[model samples]
Target chain A: MTAVASGGRVGDGSVAMLRQMIRIRRFEERCVELYSRGDIRGFLHLAIGEEACAVGVTEALDTDDAVVATYREHGHALARGLSMGAVMAELEGKVEGCSRGRGGSMHLFDAPTRFYGGNAIVAGGLPLAVGLALADRMNGRERVTACFFGDGAVAEGEFHECLNLASLWHLPVLFCCENNLYAMGTALRLTESETDLSLKAASYRIPSWEVDGMDVRAVREAAARAVEAIRSGGGPHFLEMRTYRFRAHSMYDPDRYRQKDEIESWKQHDPIPTLSEALLAEGVLTAADLVSMEEAVDAEVDDAVSFAESGTIEPVEDLERFVTTPAPADADGGRRS
Target chain B: MTTVTFRDALREALREALRSDDRVFLMGEDVGRYGGCYAVSLGLLEEFGPERIRDTPLSESAFVGAGIGAALGGMRPIVEIMTVNFSLLALDQIVNNAASLLYMSGGQFNVPLVIRMTTGAGRQLGAQHSHSLEGWYAHIPGLRILTPATHADARGMLRPALADPDPVLIFEHGSLYNVRGELDDHAGPVDLDHAAVRRPGRDVTLIAYGGTLRVALEAADRLSGAGVEAEVVDLRTLRPLDTATLLDSVARTHRAVVVDEGWRSGSISAEISARITEEAFYDLDAPVGRVCSAEVPMPYARHLEEAALPRAEDVIAAVGRLGGCGGSDG
Candidate 1:
């Protein structure tokens, strides 16, 4: 894992990481166009600048380990192995979607890969992640539950509660805080009395660190270290990814809260270009290699769009389904009706 | 049959659940070293140890959400909130996550979690510790709401609830903990559906559940001496309000009075009365009646607390308001 770290020799692993960031960026770029055409509806939260946080943390997790992510989690879902087609189909509210169109943009779920959800509510997934780790611990299974949330969730009571519980119970949880400055319109400094996010985790007596989120290699390295410590029975770990969202909080948000210069400054550190340039400078990635990667990502994104376009919506008659598990036949005879 | 208190019945049920399934463990505040807030889990800590009989911090949202997550991770978890009042802290997790998970996840994730909490106003516990909000929880889908009034149900409901693929909320009335009744020694898992006809009659139907079941039964006994043979119906499941049994009993009696510990407005009693009117309009000899608690936060004073709650006298008065049994011919 260290071999793929920044300043280390770039290899196939590093290139794959670069490719993942491009895939996420291209996918969400396509989503913006689809959203304009009204192909995707409801609140669309893009993780345009937070791809490193998603890909870095996710790549460090095992297939069997669980992941609980926020609404801005298209990158996490894609990196966790949910097909682009399935995610795109979900955004379009199609039956072929990952959640069968029940959970659109904010609630993507895939069971096989152990992806828990695309939770819409801030700080909502923290408790779920704690419980997942508790289950793994009680069952004697060595599995880490990586929970991703934004800076907004740090102010939530669930965040503090979950941190204490996870640490107290010695549960295997990797708390990935994507601290992309503003929690919606309110900046972190305004909401939090103490702006240092890692210090909050440290107060819970849990090991915490801050990483440059724009550097995918740094995120992956930090996440790997945290996941390793948790799996080795060292309890929960927290990594505050210092990043920024280049886009608005949602499609509905005008994003007037932050200045243009600030946005442009963050864009200068965009993860995709940062890693690509670093690899190019190190003679690890050629111009031809970068072009091929972009071409492949575009093709994949194009195919996903087509898949979403061809997908069908679920029937209205089945609307009442999944409200509750179907009651067993022998249990309540002639009672429910 | 052996005589037992409702508290012991609940403990036995918890013990049975813990013994039956390795995945099932009880997690709550004071459930371990401190026993339980109501002593419902008295000696189980020594029997099961800290791993199984886990005591958690006073973090309702975190533990409850963890229970849901554990359920998703293929473990059946029983999370006990000290009281329904305290459960408000975890309302978001319960409503948004536990109840919405199955439907929101496209049936891919089912939270097989059982959340047990004590409800009802009594013992002068004041405003925070009192109040019945099971009706509020009943409005949500993807979750099962159970209110066990009888010793048998208190001893039986947990098994099936743990077996349920979806989330189940068991609202145990705080006042009914000491109520003694004969529970069968072999009482196992009871069905999580339908209401039980505790007492049968033809004149009028007295509907109730949880803490109000005893009140309705007492009212029925008094009505018998007055030549008004009131039938007593115990609504076991609150969510999927056994409409069939409720409508069946209402159709037979023709006159009905709903007794609820919750308030009258937007109450479970209101829902029952409306359902009877909607489904069995012609069967009714008169309009449905209701007996409910006074609309005020439970006061610490015993007199005010008792007055605020529905008693047998209130049930009798409500039944009287429904008019005499003229048998639809009237």
Candidate 2:
């Protein structure tokens, strides 16, 4: 299905995708500055050139649908409508954080939004997605669960195991594989014997496809179709989103594995400018409109940083809380340690 | 009192759970048509239908992780992984996600999931199939490890486990499935937070659980015959150990002997010995004795397997050593 718009709603939707991408771009650019200043600690994995995949795919999901994301999930979290302040505070490890200062950048979780986690383990969230969809199916609910993982995860055993379970059980799950060429330092070609990820899913009898991850409209259209099929009892669907990550895998990496020329070349196809230029050509956005969007996103990100800075540290005494839900009154008495 | 086999008690518990709550479901390989590897889930599929007593492929990690997810989605899921040996394949999901999610998510999520797996070495299932690793699970922080040692507990622990907000692992000793006993008709949710005295006495405490509970009781019987009056303590809950009950028993008896099927090094028996030393050290009349399985991958031969495990004689020997009989390890 083509994303080309003919009416007011379609035109507005296209502009919204552009705005979401701009928001992610500005928010993460600010994260880099905050990380260097030590305001944000721990491993920070950015989706600098992967704005379209997160925005487009998340936009396709209904509010009732659940999302299971990987550690490089700031883009996915923001696009899923998690408050910018909470996401920023989580990164800053404050009491106002999404995980209450417990899970720094790698584990931003919000129960209200149905964002399952900000999982750190490779391929960890796929099985969780299958289970979430299983819950929906068992309860006779028609909600879909979107599971995001990287190309590197294909080698992990859970990737294959979860795929088979989802299909065998016919659960409503959309497996979105962000094929960003490399897993940390190892290139996909060097790792996967069959680099075609869609073929892997198809082997399990799930309808799978390849999507242009750099194009927001293309991704949105593909995700919409897959999610529609899932909701209509089509079981699980897989999308091999061919995308690229412009930043180093994490802040610690010098990223000497790939050539600087290769990075610069991928930057030429960066999703933000590509979508913005398309909008400008379509008269959906003017130079003045673009400037205002950038200014608005920058100010919003600035406010998030300030919110994170002013947030409180969790009291040290409450450290052991939540280890086990404090036992109920009728629970086995006097044995709790 | 009602007579029931351990296997039937487990099935009854599962049936009650499925009937009482729409959210409770059982999922695992061969759990439906094949009636479970141990036949504990027999007839559940037909009663609850395929949606509730769901069968899964041989993928352990996926099904177990799905149980965690289903629990998070407000459904109480009971996932059975054929045996403890098979559970190793899904260790990542169990250790990384199910056990850590609540704490890592800062309490935003709680996995009200029950994972039942057959544990202990017996019946010549050999090295791959037979092993007791429940103690390894007991080391985890966020999980509640339970070993249902009697017919009442076999029928009672599931409801409490399902009601528990955190992840609870029920390790049913494979050998006890055929053991028949009297279960009270009024039996309901059993308290899983404390150890219970199976047979009370004042001489010495015989500590064990699951398969080893029989051995401890038998040793207690032999000790009573010898006019020793040994008390038997069945540890139902492994994690969040009831040191209060344990110390009370030790304080009264003035001696303790821990019997476990798991090997000795860093085993649950070792933890008990350490606890008694820390809490009731002065109350102990001798060094705490341990009757753990000989440190060997369980052999297939019947006699060797029997020898490899902690038998009633081993518990008797440990007790005798506490009474100054000739022994080294104990």
> Which has the greatest lDDT?
1
Q: What value does the lDDT take at residue B151 in candidate 2?
A: 93
| Candidate 2 residue-wise lDDT at A302 | 89
Q: Kindly report which residue stretches of model 2 are placed more than 4 angstroms away from their true locations once superposed.
A: A1-10, A328-337, B324-330
* DockQ class, candidate 1: medium
Give the Å error, residue A279, model 1: 1.1
lDDT of 1 by residue, B175-261 (tens): 899989899989999998889999999999999999999899998888787788889999999888888898998888898999988
C-alpha positional error of residue A90 in candidate 2 after TM-score superposition, expressed in Å: 0.8
Instruction: Compute the interface RMSD for each candidate structure.
Output: 1.5, 1.1
- Top TM-score: which candidate number? 1
Q: Write the per-residue lDDT of candidate 2 for residues B1-330, one digit (tens) a residue.
A: 988899989999999999999999999999999999999999988888998988898889989999999998889999999999999999989998998887778778989999999999879989988899999999998899999999999999999999988899999999999999999888889998789999998888889999999999988777777777888999999998988999999999889999999999999999999999998999988999999998999899999999999988888877887873222323
User: What lDDT does model 1 reach?
Assistant: 0.91
